[model samples]
Target: MSFETALKTAQDDIQATLTDLLVAFDGPVGDAMRYATGGGKRLRGFLVLETSALLDVPRERALRAAAAIEAVHAYSLIHDDLPCMDDDNLRRGQPTVHRKWNEATAVLAGDALQSAAFEWLAAPLTHPDASVRAELVLTLARDAGATGMVWGQALDMAAESAEDPLTLEQITELQRLKTGRLLEWPCRAGAILGQADPVHLLRYAADIGLAFQIADDLLDVEGEAATVGKAVGKDADAGKATFVSLMGADAARDRAHALVKSAQDVLLPFGTRAATLAAVARYVVTRDK
Candidate 1:
């Protein structure tokens, strides 16, 4: 199937599973869950499924992993949109979790979503090795937690008052830690689930992860808030380290294209099996939002 078709199918499965899971809870907890997961594009989940498919893992297995990743991503978004963080009033073209509900509810909801992600991963699946599942859990936690995304956020905030302007290298390092690590985890976890070679998988994961961030930086410059579903130009306004801030807009676009090409090159070893993922890399660079 085409990447778009596969992405939509995986997204539908994730939404359905999320809905089923959320149905068991009621009141504020349920409301927070729905608010967080109800309307995003499901990019991380789509990556999990697509990467798994490329490595020939079963659809059912991919779906389970995708659901878990989506939960973590939703939780992150909830926290990121808090008044203390991005303070975003809008998300996915709707009120942010904090805006829709009370701040306390939003915080608790984010906590719940984070917990639920590991719970989903721990559940029984076709992968019989409990150890492997545990490792996947650990990998995701590290990537999404203090050592990775969270660290990146802290650094980003620090960079705001930095006396020296951020260089391209510094920007790349920050993006890798903050945004790229989470994107990389999905593909690496899928590789583990599919029992692929660790070396090849890590290489592919690193390339695509960096590519994803470059695309994100490019989008921030050119994308609209209405289309992107988040605050636009926040990077420049905040003086955060960004490719576009270091390089001109056209140069940043060129860099994004180069990264996408590099990602596709890394996937070439998988040949035809990697086509969808390769397409996704291109799509990441070219997408308007």
Candidate 2:
């Protein structure tokens, strides 16, 4: 199937699973849940499914994990747009969770969504392997928590000072932790679920994670807010560190190309099974949104 078709299928599955889980909650929790989960590219979830497919893991078996990753992603976006953070009023072309609802509701909603991700992952899988489930939950937590994405956020916030202008290496490192970790985790989790070789899984995760970040940087430079569904030029306006900021736009584009090539190279061993993922890496940099 085409990457777009595959992405849509994965997104539909994630939305269905998230809806079921959200319905169990009540009040502002439910509203926040709906708002946060409503619209997204579902990139993280797509990574899970694509990686699982490459490793021969059944799509049905990987659905819960995909949904869990998306839950965490949505929660992060909600919190990231809060007044204390980026303070953006728009996301996916709509008012942010905090703006749509009260601040407390948005905060609680983000917290609830984060907690729900772990709960979903920890729930029983059909394989009945307690060890596997535990590992999955742990992997997601480490990637989403302070040691990973959160660390990246802290670094990003800290780098906002004019005197603290980031080097190219520092910008890359920040993206790896902040934006790339979550993308990497889903692929790694899918590989683990499929019982693939650990070494190969790690390599795939690293490549895709880096590729995802490069694409994001490229998008920030060239994309439109109407299509991208997030504020553009905010990076420059905020004096934030970014690949585009460190390298000129042309250099950043070239770097993104290299990352995509590296990502595809790592997946060569998986042959045609990894075609979708390879395409996705290219699409990531090439896409306007």
Candidate 3:
């Protein structure tokens, strides 16, 4: 199958699984949860499933992991859109959770999704081996918590107030922590499931993750809100230092392409098995939203 076809399939399956898992969460909070997760590229979830598939892991177990990552992603988006954070009013071309319902509902929905991620990871259905499940839970907690994505967020908030703008090196580290870790987790999780080394996929994730962020920066600079599905030019309006702001659009685009090449190169050992992932690296930089 083509990469686009595979991606669509993965997106559909992950969405279905995620929706089914959240069926028990009823009422406004549940509605917000479902609404928050309704649409996206689903790239992170795709990484989990694709990497796991490359290693020959069972689709049933990998689907749970894929949904788990997406749930965590949705939770992060919900919280990130809150008034105290990015204060985004739009997401996925719709009113953000807090706007659609209310702050309280958004908070509860995000909280529920975050906890539910761990719940799904801990279940035996994710992996029969308790150790595998344990690793999945522990890794996700570490990645999404204080030392990883949260740390990145803290750095971002700090950068907003600091007298000096973040240097390129600093911004790279910030994005690595805030964004790279979660992207890396899927590859690591896939490796754990297959009992294989994740060094190559880890490298691949690192490169692609940065490229993905650069793409997002480009979208903010060049894309319309209607096209990008959220606020555009917020970084510039906020005087935030971004890849585009620091490097200029042309240089940033070049860098993203370079990163995509590196990402694809690192997956060479996996050969044909990594084709879809290579396509994903290209898609990361080229996507409109």
Q: Pick the candidate with the highest lDDT.
A: 3
Candidate 2 local Cα displacement, residue 34, angstroms: 1.8
List the candidates ranked by TM-score, beginning with the highest.
3, 2, 1
Q: What C-alpha RMSD separates each model from the true structure? A: 1.6, 1.5, 0.7
* Candidate 1 TM-score, C-alpha based: 0.94
True-vs-predicted CA distance for residue 62, candidate 2, Å: 0.6
User: How big is the positional error of residue 114 in model 3, measured in Å on the Cα after superposition?
Assistant: 0.6
Clashes of each: 0, 0, 0
TM-score of 3: 0.99
Candidate 2: minimum summed lDDT over ten consecutive residues — where? 123-132
Runs of candidate 2 exceeding 4 Å displacement: none
lDDT of 1 at 259: 75
Per-residue accuracy of model 1 over 1-289 as CA lDDT, tens digit each: 8877877887789888778767767889778887788867777778888788877788887777777778888888889888887789988888888898889998999898888878877777736789878878889999998899899888877777789878888878888888888788888788888887656656666776777787788778788988987778887787676777778778877877787788788887789988888888887777766
Q: lDDT of all predictions, in order shown?
A: 0.80, 0.82, 0.93
- Residue pairs whose backbone atoms clash in candidate 2: none
Q: Write the per-residue lDDT of candidate 2 for residues 1-289, one digit (tens) a residue.
A: 8888887888898888778778889998788888888868888888888888877777776888888888899899888999998899999889999998978888899899898888888888623677778888888899999999999999988887548689888887988899888988888888788877656656766766776676677677778999988888887777777777777788877877887888888889888888998887887777777
